[model samples]
Target: MKRLIGAGLAVVLVPVLLLSMLVAVLFGSEDEAQAAPPGGQPGVVCTTAPASGSGGSAGSTTGQDVAGFSGDQLDNAAVIVGQGKALGVPERGWVVAVATAMQESTLRTLNYGDTMANGQMSSSRGLFQQLDAWGPLADRLDPAKSAAMFYTGGQAGQPGLLDIPGWEQLPVTVAAQRVQQSETPDAYAKWEQPANQVVGAVEGRTCTTTPAAGAAGGTSISLPSNPRAETVINRALSQLGVTYSWGGGDANGPTLGIHDGGVADAHGDYAKVGFDCSGLALYAYAGIGVAVPHQTQAIWAAFPHLTDRTTLQPGDLLLYSSNGAANGIHHVGIYLGDDRMVEAPQSGDVVKISSGIWGGNRGAEFIGAVRPGA
Candidate 1:
């Protein structure tokens, strides 16, 4: 009788003790909870902006104007900005988030998509038109939860701005695409100006600034002792935000872009007015008193080829080609030492610092490096 009583007591006591400890561990102290980051709550803290005028108009009280949106739309935009602030995204990120929401759902917390043939709504919903892949319907419909998910991605493995390398320096549209992966990647660009305006209106500050040049990932390449190489790198860096065009730049400078009549034309890149890959390289080399051709194959032919990548020096042209043949070279970029290179990547893109010369869609046949004037 005594043994059975002791066993029963032990069973009840052990569980009770375990439960007490678990509760303490989970809750922690009041100070610890307070110290936790925002968004730790079940939902983000949302505050309605003060209305303007005697009529209590929905426009911002901060004196900046947010026209064209109703009270509900402005409120949803505020939520996105709030979530972005909670997540520690920069001011530029706030602009991006608001712009993305503006484009995706026009700041509406949608509950359904266009009706399908079966009379059911499409899977996409919420302020971002997020599909079921983003999260559960309840979470998606909650403006705060959806905004957090958009900024940090979600329980699923969808890409977000935090996941993208050098997202800060990327064009607004490109950064948004890194997360959204929309069918029409360039569509987001149109929303950038309005987004900046809305963010400025909500935050009560100017927000028309572009991302600062050389503000992306830190400079990977160490400056070489060669003066000419330094000039080439600096020249390339000067054109950081210039948009990519099929046949845009030259030895003189950036020229008005001409239509490629190819995939580039489909993106409305004919009027972009910037540099192509080889054209950028041509302009950079020209800055150093070296005249290089505006064609990749011709540029490769103009210089002595370095058979080994280890022998490559700053200002060398890193050439990529479909095949490892002389005539096969199609893309050219100025190497900036280390693994970094400066190139104007594709139409509807821009001149930017790429971490590696050959990767992704650019096949691995590195036709080798060309040292101009070596």
Candidate 2:
């Protein structure tokens, strides 16, 4: 009788246990799903010595070694870099000045711009293409004086890097944008790569920011141990300071203008933009052969759930949602290790790195992470 009772109890409990497990699988708790991803050895190992002798000492008059540039162009580039040093700007500042000059005037010290519709001069000139408001006409035309004005504001109170608080922490393009206030703010970003090369050649040493030779399109600093992860992170980093426009980027690249008028218009960002949050992730992952949807919710659904956040690798994504619902997912950022993340924040912002991904209300509720192509 005792043995028969025990057998009956076991038989009853087994089916209940099985059913409970099925329910758990079908409707797991948010805590269970949100468990942090595992952490371990870095997926990619990057080993490259840092470059030497960034910007030279002030007033050193050191000769530069610029290759593939005409004598006049090289001379002007040196003047720009030298003036940056004289103004106490760092090597990164030198790169920004040179790159800005390259885009504005090709270091040619232009004396004028196309006549306006009103038949008046555009009043833009010099390596930086300063307007007459930048300084007296003669000062705008003088290379050394103009470069100085570029780094340190001229008599007209035009803001320079020194004038902008925390300019050093901003990306090269952003720092330049703060000073130039160009109509096309993103144009300066294109010159960063070439500018790095020019600075490296001039300094007779590799620039710390120089991307590795043959790096996918020569746009990345170093490749990681995981080739795909390397491509994703590098491609994303290459877009630092790119404008955040709603529906502005796709797998291919940045689109011409803002395509979505709903949320983007609400944010007052209707101009041509670079990338939004999900769009940046989409493009970055696509570079590594991973297809991520442009919408945040779809991107979250596409990747396999990482059970442990600590295990998140470099290219993994940290997604955010307001209510933990499928449609609630609204933001995404790529993890860069050491608690850093790269993101194309909301309107009026640019692609940049932030210290923590979960500090703000938008990221308050942990929605777990996903590793694409892992």
Candidate 3:
């Protein structure tokens, strides 16, 4: 059993989950994104934003579990939290939303919902058990849409989380109760801890504000002292100016990208031939026979990650995460000494050297450096 800390109180959490419900559909999706490179390199050609649509990532740690959250469950959690972020829901709102989902549907996107009084089956469905009054059935089924509805509410009479006055000051259960109106209003409290864990894991480190001063500009590469490192840098640098395709690039070379169902899709990344953040890193390292998986987190764990960013050398992969933890890693780049790095940033951008480790990419926290073949 674990203990969950809340507003001046703590609640014991039973590690085991008791399922009294049926399984339902799960949801999530992703790739990676970025900004510019060194001097006068036809960098990020387009800055205009794409048409708004659904967006999701397969959560950072998709293949693993966290706090007993399986890949699917975690993926759904990611969607819920991601949708919250897109709608400007604060972190507190994210916790409340996830906790409510845990109590209502155990984080699964349910096809069936609760039955209310008078013997008629309530039309509640989806992750938060939204009802027929919440809008169309399709919106309730999509994790992203459902999450958006949960945070923003639907229909004329219904109100979402933010619509509840003082929701920020309320406890997880209280806030959730205002939105869900569950029979067991207090049930949301027990999930507070796990919900926090889920949100933190999915949201990761985000820095909207500028980072502290560090090496930032100039496209010139200062080749690493190590031959292996030099080789990797050369190969990565060769790909400079390449378009950034979500899920594109591999150990062999650039490949087709997968759909992200949102901004990336609008940018037509799925049809482009190029590399994403980690894909570029893995492909570059392949030149030196250093085979790492295409995923950022995998590459982070595949080699010795430097604890001190100041010790970075050329060809070392700089890892960034949504959260500061390893499990939150989502992007990677080739470190080209003097604070410069090459990366395939995001939709509508090209492979280029950034001014610093945190250059071009917003909301991505610079975690550390991964030296492949070190």
Candidate 4:
């Protein structure tokens, strides 16, 4: 009896020790891990901006009156101009509007749900998200007008502007909060540096007050720099009539969304393996110098502007509605021009290029156009 009891205690005690060890491993402190560099690699600044370009002289800036921002803030005014111009806003007004948008939205046209209550999110939309219900509003839903109005008329003395003190004289962030009445007033300030850099690169300007390049002479609606953009478009076109897969947008992906890295299988045709919406863009731009993100929201956030479908160009990204009944981006494709696009299609299909079709219907929601290399 004594021997049997001792053996039973050993079995229970051994498992208890192992279980404690497992718990220790599983619940180990994460602070040390966070302190370590990502992927166990050190010396990487995860948030560094891309290198600037040698893209020539940015002209003078003439826009709404802004006084409080530091002179250095104007460095990226050109990128803001190029970005705003893409959105169809005038250059002078573009600077002011961009400053405001950088203040309000950080130049990103987000689709995520906002904290603002009421229908401001529903009726008012895009980068500015201005509401039509607001008195004397210009197509408030339009990013251009909304940005302009927000910039030009944002005043602290105004009733709604009271939330932001000294808004008119404050930096873009303060002014934007006054106009937007956002719960978080300081959010827009984070974009100041990046917004300025992008604007300066695209517009070729040193400051918001500089004379802008002949507005019409700058930025033609032309092809971006992805050298392989044309090649991939051609390759995808060669695979027309392939069936669609759920996650099957790349060459190496299985069916759809089946492959790792979200790349579709190459389907073993031209050895043209692994290309999803981002993959296609990546390969295309790799031919040039730029690299795009893989995910849809990241791609949208990285791009310059939301362009109209009528002005679609080769290598432009085409997004389709996903939210059952013509809303929310569920799929994406590459525009090959001439109303033709290259896409993975849907489930039961291999990676192939064909006339665009979204959910068995030709009238897929045209989310917007993106110029891959500007």
What is the TM-score of each predicted model, taking all chains together? 0.47, 0.61, 0.40, 0.30
How would you encode candidate 4's per-residue C-alpha lDDT over 106-170 as one tens digit per residue? 34343332433454334444345444444333334344444444544332233333233333233
What lDDT tens digits, residue by residue, belong to model 2 across residues 68-110?
3445666777788778767887776787888788777776777
Candidate 1, 329: how far from true, in Å? 9.2
lDDT of 3 at 366: 81
Model 3: weakest 10-residue lDDT segment is 22-31
Reference-based lDDT, residue 20, model 3: 16
Candidate 1 has what TM-score?
0.47
Model 1: residues with Cα > 4 Å off, grouped in runs: 1-67, 114-121, 212-374
Candidate 3, residues 138-182, lDDT tens digits: the string is: 998888998898899887468899898656644455567768766
Give the runs in model 3 whose Cα sits over 4 Å from its true position: 1-225, 358-364
Best by lDDT: 3
Task: Mark the 10 consecutive residues where model 4 has the least summed lDDT.
Answer: 13-22
Question: Which candidate leads in TM-score?
Answer: 2
Ranking by TM-score: 2, 1, 3, 4
